[model samples]
Target: MLLHTFLAPLALASVAGPAQQDHYGWIHLFDGKTLEGWTEKGGPYDGDADWSVENGVILGREAEGARGGLLYTEQLFGDFEFECDVKINAPFDSGIFVRMLPQKRGAQFTLDDRPGGELFGIYSNGYLFHQSGGDAAWRSGEWCHTRVRCVGHPMHLMGWIDGKLVVDYQVPEGMDEAFTPEGRIGIQVHGGMNDPEDAAVRFKNLRARRLPPMAGENFTVDESGMMTLTAVGEASGWQPLFNGVNLDGWVPNGGSGPMTAEAFEAAGYRARNGVIEALHSGTAGEIRTARTNYRNFQLRMDFQLTKLANSGVYLRSVDDGTNPSFNGTEVQILDDFNWEAASGSKLAPYQFTGGLYGAVAPSKSALRPIGEWNTYLITCVGSRMNCALNGTLLWDVDTATLEPKGGPPFAERAKAGFIGMQRHGSAAESESEVGASFRNLFIRELPEMGPSAR
Candidate 1:
């Protein structure tokens, strides 16, 4: 089957050919003749579901004297599109599960075909959303094409059965804390229901493609070697902090107070042609969001630095003219390759890129080459902070456990404040015009649970 058909509705034509398989990012979960990439015993309740491959399909039946369980992918997926074809005998129950693990209650897309059963409904601890008329789309005893697109931080899920949309739901803000960001995908054979011993559920064409967190938008590089955004739908709550035109929502920290965007520009920062460029000037100061009190949030941005450039991302920074690196927290961003040679000083463990500035060091350096764009995903939830550089996790630490260099413990710092970006003057002695550039700055605030909740 042409898997591209599943993504046609999204207008992702750029990912349509075999030569662009990396861009397509689709992996066939099942080879149609074996269970090489699947396992049945990883989940908490590994049921005795008789699973085998026959006639280019995965066949599942209840083991003798046993009920049923799940068969899950050996690997895990975060945001992705999952597609399959299911054929279930009537009066049997089965489902497709996402973000599933032994310790986590991942959401499920119901394939229940029993009398009075609900198909395509989402279930976790309870019915997240129950399908009202899903049976109308069910093709019993036949291959029913199924697709589920799961994306975003809180997880927006959409399911289609035989090309008919049946489930469209997003995890509510209040319930977002319950669902994890990633886990294994599973196929379930529900237990405890009485049925014929020969009843079975068959699946084939099982495939999935990883998706970016931005959902309907594609970030692409143009022929001129600049990044651009292609929007296809809503960004699912991810809001652009830099509009690619100007710094309207940002203010320059002028040591005494927050200054206007004009001051930010005068301080050598300008947003032009979808990129925020910081000029290499000694007078350049930090720029922060005009909006403050960001308690729990996920911040994503792409940045590229010149040789010996130094910078940091300040989180929950106070507005009292104090250094944000002490008042809140700073994730160090530096030219990891050339900083030591340029500055004549060895970098401490906590001074490396992606480290919690002066507090916790990253496990390893994950920075891209200088002059190449690197992505940062910084998530701050209560007292815990995680930083992933260029898709590799650098650290996931509880800030309350440690103290910043020459500063108070993180537990005593401001719990909620502004998000800022620092433009530390170049480390090179020649005073070169080497500074950092940023783009695609986006943020999504999560539901705030206080420190006690952690």
Candidate 2:
């Protein structure tokens, strides 16, 4: 069972106006009376469409025989939050496009006939993500509200329908370089054959707010502009935490036998070439740095999960515990899609990859597809922590706000402890048998912040 909840309308946070003013410095994108600061493109006959402002709404009703294209914002933006209300009749297709380039390179937040709030990455030929399915939030008689947040640096994108948080996505590595971080915002009139005069889409209440840029190489700032944590870079005096060829400075735990390198290796934890890999051995385990106990530090590593595989990186923990996750902290690493579909399995939002297991949920899903390597940068200082998956800020949160499941209270978590990785087993509950691998493990210790810093 996947705990994916959509909030009720009354329970949703404010989407616009002074209620949102202090939280987000919003700027109106649509003046309502005219399509100023916007340009039209693409249609049956090259940028030709029956697009006009009518009754305070931007309407795109195709002319006879005209296929639709886009009405785009002239100004370009990078990291920002956007909101709008849309009304579309049945048998029509439209979308909200961001970072749009000339050849359809960018991302789209869908307004299709299917689930109305899904994200798709567009390229010259097709889309990058093919996921689809969700509740039909649209009605024949009423307008639908949608909200989107696309943040750069650690590029994370999110979407909400009727104020219900739905799509939380992370742009893949290398994929970011394909389109400009700053590009036009577009209202798409999907190109296809349809009854030109009858097919219509209207948009209103368009507004957006810009987010602060990612400031430091070692640290990250949240959307509201708060310093979360830091990842020490090469120039910042960071050192290798894993030496690649051997477990020279580490200890393995969670097994029932001798805790030696050989025992761990036999238990499926192995060092091959320059990578630390956990082959499938049907046993759950972990490995921790032997002599290092870190408080405020940045830990970076590259991880690859086999199809449906599961594992994790532990922070500030002891090796003697049976459940180190509850004892310390575990940044979950697992195949979210497969893990959720496993038989007899139940997963909460806080149990997915990049999540602070059983505590805080990741604001977005940022993992690469299983079988591909993804980079992770985790920084913990005082009560603040941040995780960046593949150069995207997955989430930034203050630990004091998290509610724990079955451990020492979240507020009372350890100040300093060893860094480690969990070696998951094929438990009877899930009966999963996928493998996990890691490499390029590095860490940089920072001076613990005092009371004033907290």
Best by TM-score: 1
Tell me the TM-score of each prediction against the true structure. Answer: 0.51, 0.50
Structure candidate 2, residue pairs in collision: 218-231
Distance from true location, Cα of 395 in model 2, Å: 2.2
Per-residue lDDT for 350 in model 1? Answer: 85
Error of 2 at 19 (Å): 45
lDDT of 2 by residue, 194-255 (tens): 64356688899988655533324543444433333355545675677777667777766643
lDDT of each: 0.75, 0.66
The parts of candidate 1 lying over 4 Å away from their true place are 1-23, 216-361, 364-387, 390-454
lDDT of 1 at 399: 87
lDDT, candidate 1, residue 407? 71
TM for candidate 1 is 0.51
